[model samples]
Target: MTVIVGASAAGLACAEALRRKGYTGPLTLVGAESHLPYDRPPLSKQVLSGDWEPARARLRSAEALSALDATLVLGDPAVHLDVPERAVHTASGRILKADNIVLATGLRPLTLAGQPTLRTVDDALTLRKRLLGCTNAVVVGDGVLGAEIAATARRMGVAVTLAGPQSAPMALQLGPRVASELASLHAAQGVSLRLGAAVTEVSEDGVLLETGEVLPADVVVVAFGSAPATDWLQDSGLTLGNGIVCDSRLRAAEGIYACGDVARWHHETLGRMVRLENRTNATEQGIAVAANILGADEAFLPVPYFWTDQFSAKIHVHGFVSPDATVVEGSASEGRFVVRYHRDGAVTGVLGWNMPKQARQHRAEISLRCPAGVAASTPGAA
Candidate 1:
């Protein structure tokens, strides 16, 4: 029997992948929420804007889930995991035993001074209802989630204020020059920019900045990142750093594997451990974990890909980048352009602002130049 905890995107994907790989083992999935696995990207956009219903965010259909032939234990969280005994204790006092275990508990939104967050479907529904009577909203932390929420609320005719410590939203991920363009895009869409503004206090009225300025807000949503949902495994006796640390094959222990946002596995190409909080990584890692569990030597090495939609623009990024990178392609000012991130004469990452074709063309360069000095040797690939 293969027991998978947390029946979200990662858990569901892992189960399906196992079946696809001809693993006719007993499969079981345990989830805290009663609902099946669903897509989360639309929660901040379509669902919040009332353009799509909550059911539309589902990752798979009821028929598809039934075909997976996995027994689902819903509305109960796994509280304890015993590696040696190979058992999972649930919140409902149920003990599930398995030959192998897959941890897919994903992550919980990091609280920002007690502010509300958007992670689950219920949270999105509640937030959408709150925005109905809200005229203005103050969103703390200008990360990817914050940007999406602010843009969505702005489009919904609510006055939105985006405040963060960074000089520009997504600056850390997209680099300064590209992030500045995104900031300008948000500003043009009637979203108030509070870049570099440190939040001092969050109250009923709004968010108070360190500069003695209070932003009047009817609702406050905190998008300040997230931490791995590994508290349940505190004494489970597995390494945890930023997330459940895994090997290059995405294995947590001898008979245990992990995937999705919860597992920060070693990336052999990048030579570091990385936990990606995106849809692409979750799906890919889940599939890889299934293969690895069945005695496959899949490395789980992938060129990272992520995309975000705000206003009328779509931003796509591929691979890793450093702080000081030379742009080798088009400029950020152009509506459609490709920007290459270089470190030590090697192309480390690629950014596409509505330029998917050009961005994909440099995919090989990312893998070939992952090492420090490989760029000089592979002149044609670079």
Candidate 2:
């Protein structure tokens, strides 16, 4: 059997791709969650805001999952992988023997010392339940997820405050200027902003900031990014870094491969080991890794893409851009603009703040330029 670990986007996509690649062997997918594969993006938006139920986050229906032709081991995670024995041991003590293994365990949220955190469906629903008749909410990160949660909480009639140690919200991802505009939009939507201060501790009432300000909140959420869910592979003899260390082909070890947020593979185009935590990379890497699993040997070098939607704003990003080197290309005050980030002399990244058409145009151009310090080898669309 070809055993696939994880049941989210990466796992399910990999399973489907394996079928597409004509793998007719016994297939088994082990998932940590009890529920079937579901879309995670809505957890912070519609689901958290009570606009949609937890069931509405389903990525594929029961009928669709039944068509995948794979045995599913749900709600039980693989705790151990005996590399030499070629077997997996799950939490329920079920042993699975496999000829090949695909590691797509994805990421675990890096939350603060205290308060509730959001990553899975249960986390979102718990926060939603807590938000019922809640007057104040505090989100303990200024990144995309934190900002989204704060926005959702604010829209749900809860006064929200986003606290983090950045100059502006989502600065690391969208750069300071564009992130500043996004921060402004959040502020205009009645969400309080607490930038440039780290949360020291979480209390029953609120969080204590580094600068000694205590913001009282009825609902506190910690969204301090995430790390790889790779603890299960520590004893498996596979290399582990920020994520499961993989080659350019997404191969971690002999007969073992990885993809999605959990796979930190060396990106040939970027000339670095990049672990992207976005839907684009997860799905793209799944497709690419499936081909590699079928002996394609194609290098996974992608012009990274991610999108974020927050209160009347939609941001689309393409390519690699440092937060400190970003500059606005058009009128950011007008709300619909593109933020162009340069690497050396060439444009290496583009961010579209409601400028989707123009941003799509620059992707082909941006992919051609090598990253700031890397030497150019393959040209555009490689």
| Candidate 1 wrong stretches, greater than 4 Å | 324-333, 367-382
TM for every model, in the order presented, reads: 0.94, 0.94
Instruction: Mark the regions of model 2 whose C-alpha exceeds 4 Å error after superposition.
Output: 323-330, 372-382
Query: What does the lDDT come to for candidate 1?
Result: 0.83
Error of 1 at 364 (Å): 1.8
Q: In lDDT terms, how accurate is model 2?
A: 0.82
Per-residue lDDT of 310-368 in model 2, one digit per residue for the tens?
Answer: 98898888876554344455676677887777766777778788888888887776743
Cα TM-score of candidate 1: 0.94
Tell me the tens digit of each residue's lDDT in model 1 across 1-382: 9999979888888899999999998999999898888888899999888998999999888999899999989999999999998899999899999998999998899787767799998889999998888888998988889999999999989999999999998887787877888999999999999889789899876899988889998899999677889999999999988888899999999888999888888778767666777778888888998988888987987777788899988888887645655556666556777777777677777778887777888766874334532121011111
Candidate whose lDDT is highest: 1
